[model samples]
Target: EVAPQCRTASAAGFFAVAMYYQGADHASFRPLCPAIVEPQHYVREEPLFSSMAAGERRAVRRRRLGWFAHQVHQNSRTLIGGWVTGLFGAIATVPMVARILAPRLTSQIRESMGSLVRPPATELHLERLGNNPGSDPESMGYSLDEMSQIVVRILQDIGMVKDFPPTIVFFGHGSGSLNNPHESAYNCGACSGGRGGPNARAFAMMANDPRVRRRVSQLGIELPDEVRFVGAYHNTCNDDVDYYDLDLLPRSHRELFRGIESDIIETRARNAHERSRRFESAPLGLTPQEALEHVEERAEDLSQARPEYNHATNTLVTVGRRDWSRGLFMDRRAFVTEYDPAVDDKDGHILTRILQAAIPVCGGISLEYYFSTVDVEGYGCGSKLPHNVASMVGVMTGAASDLRPGLSQQMVEIHEPMRILFVIETTAEMLSRIIVENEGIRRMVEGNWVQLAIIDPSNSAIQRYVDGHFEPHLVSDMQLPTVQSSMRWYRGQRDHLGFATIQEPESDQPMNSSESNASAAGALA
Candidate 1:
């Protein structure tokens, strides 16, 4: 009974080590009984060899570092003199280099580069204007016409051109923590690890303008006079939502805003409750309000290693209407983007724009988590327990070490390392064309860096893209458990919970006879 399982486990471990050594970047291993250990005789000797190999690699790394340090110490004077000379030479040639590159360094070029010489690289925490337009007038901000277009595009993209809500809240998300050097890791990736509140506030202010609204109406998407746009910031670490420009709110809209605020308060408590399940320090029996308070304290605590698991366990990105995924428990593992194919042109211009940002950003985040989780010491920055912020440049181990570029162990402790799955609401043909045309998207999909699937907008059917072709995915017949509320489903659980539908008392459906019989049989057994 256990021999096959032991063999499978050994093979899986061997394959994983082989894949790692061979540089098979995308390979993943799943053991049949990962938590169970076989008898010593049942285990294989391959893992011992792999461990020795790992030790050798570590020794090699240490030798290289030692050699560099020895050279630096022996030739300190020569190296320092050479560095000084080079610095001075570069300073002296700055005028010449600037003059030579003057023609190439145009205002348009600078604007395109986000007014910086180098592009924003999240690995180094460099800030950029991201996909959304920023408040910087010349470099990142947009004109009135551009803002109107953005408004229309947002509406059309989200399938909200008609039936506009009275008060539309644009919520920008960021994190809050005390005495955490890697605080930026918890902020919005779209904003280049900066607070996104300003972006949301700017967009809301622009959309609320009568002039922008007039132009948008001329473009065929009319906003009612009563419609108002409100900007808000969500502190993910503390689970708090704060509204901006409330003083500018109309007298008539006060009641509506108040109701929205109430709903947000309730949502914050529930969200905190869901997130609290992952924290060992948090009690499983905590109420929603208690969970909220617990998370709030975590944000403010100086000793909190994990203000929150930033992007951990992110497995999928779904680009489509909210209706398809509504009422489904996502377990906070999916990034949902609003896109309406019905409103898109045949050329899929809107979809293309969305993917241009979505594919790279989401894929980058997923890959970062994947690598960090797979080899925490080698790929990741290692444990942040002894990390020190060096001169505000980056994090270093102990007092001095190499600047760690990847995530910390606390951030990726619970992450499941796998290539991210991208589910888009579009036809297979459109997706194929997208994959073919966009070089970045092509490399990611074709190279198997990300898994692709298209969901039919008409019937909500899914077709996975595999080996350059779309294969229809078989829908499962298994039913998700039902509960009256999230608390009912999550109560007394301190580990990962499966999906369960929350329903009102009246709408809760009774289990079918077949499932009931199966349950009875299992219980009896």
Candidate 2:
């Protein structure tokens, strides 16, 4: 049913996606559903194979490259003397050779500076987030009746009935930057992109096991011996949170884990003053403790060129109920998935696994930021200001050609290339039998890549999806301006503004946004 001009992933919207790197289950990032099928073997069983192998499907060619093992532990005269010192135009001795041999190098000078930058990995010191013994994939780790039918089917795919949320706090997002080569495409795309802190420290050690909470209250779903599933780690690139099991949290839930870590350190300083209004050397109206110490020193600035705009204007993905995209404004551009579509009455079965994992993880992160912001030098892999992490798997520019995978150009230059609207709730005949029984959610609803819609999880009847059905997406009501916070409706505003009905959020006074103004031309769905 797709066809709003083939939805996007081409004509400069990128997604040539050929994906491999299977095993650690993100099962090769769906594009032609990993060449036909094996959607995590319908919820896991060590997928030795289900799809990917018609001579192993191909296409993601940006000159196939993948170095890291300490970037080919250098040789060939220390990789032609660091490409003849980046072509004799030394560029200010590359940040003083990236700050004094980036911490006393040697594993043979870190395989000669990890062949020109970015190699740090250590620190897993996991004291206890427990249940380790053989960490089963099938010697059968998941059976207390398969972890209570995978915790009552992910609490009926996020609708959650009988108990939880006194302190469920799974959070588990991830992404770090420095010399970013799409840092595992800024992680947590259902941990295929990886780092959802060991799947939220292994689902808070299998929902605080007492034999999986007595097989999740013998499947009636109750979980509350002073309910405590913490395991955190937000860092959705520098928004930084971290918790993880806190030695199995319960001294009667330590004052509800110190009031949910002071409302997540005041929502990570109002999400770093809404990502320091898209960082122009941050520091304006400061205080969310000076914009969380300027985004914890721009997540340790390796010549910081926007380290934290990781998902940059991600564009509305609402699965359902943050009571309908919360108090209006969503400039931290919505990916909100709570889901409650009346717990599936019309057989949408948790709205078809929340649109089969939010239509390829929010349409593969909005067609990989709308083809890396509509082509930043051939589907983006340009600009991280003269990138060179050539061997540590990807990114290459100064030290030769080829090996330029997507995302860069200062991370899709403020990114707004569109295509992901996705807004689901339920209906339109249970979303057209989940868009005619999934051919990978009908090739992302017939290649309009992602735009589908629905709304009414009992009221505001929106609709959208087109060319092959559903309609009424009209909008027009009024009473906008509300604020009391969003740092006083974007304190010292930078630009792109819209949607204001805030009514609470008070770091002295601020701003979903049917977002427009980042210099509006489109986006309303």
lDDT of 2 by residue, 1-525 (tens): 001111101000001111221222232422212222232211121212432331132212211324332343453248675775456646767665554345222123434654332212211211223343122233213335555665566666665555344556555566775555567776655545655554444455566777777877877778777666655666766677777548667676576567446756776777777778778888677877788766765655555666676676787777765555556777777666656766666677766765666677767777888897888778877776776776567777887888887788777677788887878777688788778887888878878888888886666789987977889977787568887666677778876678787663332211111111001000111
- Pull out the clashing pairs in model 1: none
lDDT of 1 at 91: 71
Roughly what TM-score does model 2 have, to 2 decimal places? 0.28
Report the Cα lDDT for candidate 2: 0.57
Task: Give one digit per residue, the lDDT tens place, for model 1 in 1-525.
Answer: 101101000001110000001011112221111122111111111112324555445445656666887875566469686686565666756544443344224323434753222211111001123444332322233446766876776666556677565677777677877658888877766545555554455556667889889999999898988778776678888888877667778997787677557656877898898899999899888888999988877775555788898678998888887666655666778787777788899999989977776777678789989998999998999999999999878999998899998899999999999999989999999999988999988999999999999998878788999899999999786688877666777677765567777563331345432212110000000
Error of 2 at 109 (Å): 28
Error of 1 at 393 (Å): 2.4
Give the C-alpha miss distance for residue 23 in model 1, angstroms: 44
Q: In model 2, which regions exceed 4 Å deviation?
A: 1-94, 97-178, 187-272, 276-300, 303-306, 309-316, 319-333, 336-358, 363-430, 442-454, 457-483, 488-525
